[model samples]
Target: MLVSIRVAAEELGVRPETLRRWESQGKIEAPERTPGGKRRYDLAKLRHLAPHKAPSERVTILYARVSTNGQRDDLVRQRALLETFSSANGWPYEVIEDVGSGLNYHKRGLKQLIAQICSGRVGRLVLSHKDRLLRFGSELVFSLCEHFGVEVVIINASENSTFEEDLASDVIEIVTVFSARLYGSRSHKNKQVMDRLREVAKEVSP
Candidate 1:
């Protein structure tokens, strides 16, 4: 069914003049004309037009990550590169950074970005490299992007030392967690000794 220009514009949260202007600019198809030559918008067409955000209007996400705190400088560099890349593409974007293992899914920033992607607010995802997004399951995210009509751009698709670094970091993290657990368990009988042992484990963690 069709609605009058005024009603359609109100429902779409735009002024009637704005809709008319967009129609004249060919940004959207013209609404159907009434017998009296007044414009009326089809509900289906109006809804479809609502999501057609222009490149500048769309939300772009620049995601960057490093495997450890020792690589904070690398995180800064990655954010800078993402900012430059997004600027060159002529779109404003939010930079999301994570300082944790790529193989881990519990990063706060990563979860927030994924929520935005699934919510349909994200129009594009820009990454310096694919592995920068994840170590193994990055394709699952890319598939989600494809399903949501979000474009994925990789500035440097070439594999670098990042993959190996993440592997090493993951190994260290796994070992540390197990060592901590083992130490605590074996020393449960001696509370004072267990506390000191955990402290030493923390000092040795890299």
Candidate 2:
């Protein structure tokens, strides 16, 4: 699908002006111009800016995340499906697995995959669904992929509904933030209790 500069900017979390500047600087290639001189970005161009690499001689990377231990079998199935997809397409593939909450991509395997993408080791990233790869906001991840000239393929039906994904991400962010706060408060209380016990022991000794 073709998108206007404004829509592309919104999807990419960048100012339209910045995209223009990047085009001018040759950091990013300029999109095709319409008869009316409006810029139009194709899926190819947008994927070129993905956090992963464009399909080249390099192998594609498949990232699979299972939210819990019980989903380990699901993770394997995902990997198998990706391998089959790659084989059917005649593409080389590498698989990365993370057994953690999809709420974040900071897991060790995911981090390694990102490192490879940033280093230009992988040509493309394939995920079963946006939510499978992004329980958090995909904007940052997409931006990173784009900056590195990577390509991404979401194998699900919803393609790329940035608005819906953003809403879901906001909810996940709130939960994560609150969970962290609660953990911090509990830690603080535990520290205080330990401190009081130390003081009591010292007073009794004196």
Candidate 3:
């Protein structure tokens, strides 16, 4: 996909002039020019900024997550599928699994993933589905990955939710977060609230 310099800079959390400077400094690939002489960047190439570390030292990561302990079987299956995919591609990969709510950003697995990415030890990230990373704000992680020149691969990109489904998800996420905050995560009251909300969510969903 092609995007204007402003869009690319915004995604990277950098100023537009920084992109122009990087282009001039050979830090990034030169962008395509429009008929009116405006610059357009290839989104894919823009993601692969020059890495700070040697390629051989970086590892590909296969990450999976499930909302609760009840989904252990699903998590295992996700791990196995990711391993098979990486093996087929002959990539040296490691698997990171999390049993937590997607709305929670403080997951240990997620923290470790961010640390590795910041340390320049991640060459790529592979996911079975996009939301497997987070219920929301997955793009922030992707932006960090892009800033560090880590390639992102999503095996199932067609699993997008309809508007109604998304609304259901958002409702559930809000309930889950606020219930935990109001009643404490392990409190019986929170459990009761979640149980009722889940039913309501199902009713509203397709």
User: Number of the top candidate by lDDT?
Assistant: 3
- Scored by CA lDDT, what does every candidate get? 0.74, 0.69, 0.83
Give one digit per residue, the lDDT tens place, for model 3 in 85-148.
9999898999899988899999999999999989988888999999999989998998787678
Residue pairs that clash (backbone atoms under 3 angstroms), model 1:
none
Candidate 2 residue-wise lDDT, 1-206, digit = tens: 88998777655544466579888999777788999999998756665555322546766888888766777889899888888887888878888888766666578987898789788766677888777776766667766766765666667736665665456544544444445545677787755655555455444431
**1 or 3, greater by lDDT:** 3
Candidate 3: which pairs clash?
none
Query: Model 3's lDDT to the true fold?
Result: 0.83
Q: What is the per-residue lDDT of model 1 for residues 142-200, given as tens digits with 9 covering 90 to 100?
A: 76775565667788865555545655544555554455556666666555555565565
What's the CA error at residue 73 for candidate 1, in Å? 0.5
Per TM-score, the best of the predicted structures is: 3
Per candidate, the number of residue pairs that clash is 0, 8, 0
User: Relative to the unseen true structure, what is the C-alpha lDDT of residue 27 in candidate 2, on a scale of 0 to 100?
Assistant: 79
Regions of model 3 farther than 4 Å from truth: 1-57, 180-194
TM-score of each: 0.56, 0.56, 0.70
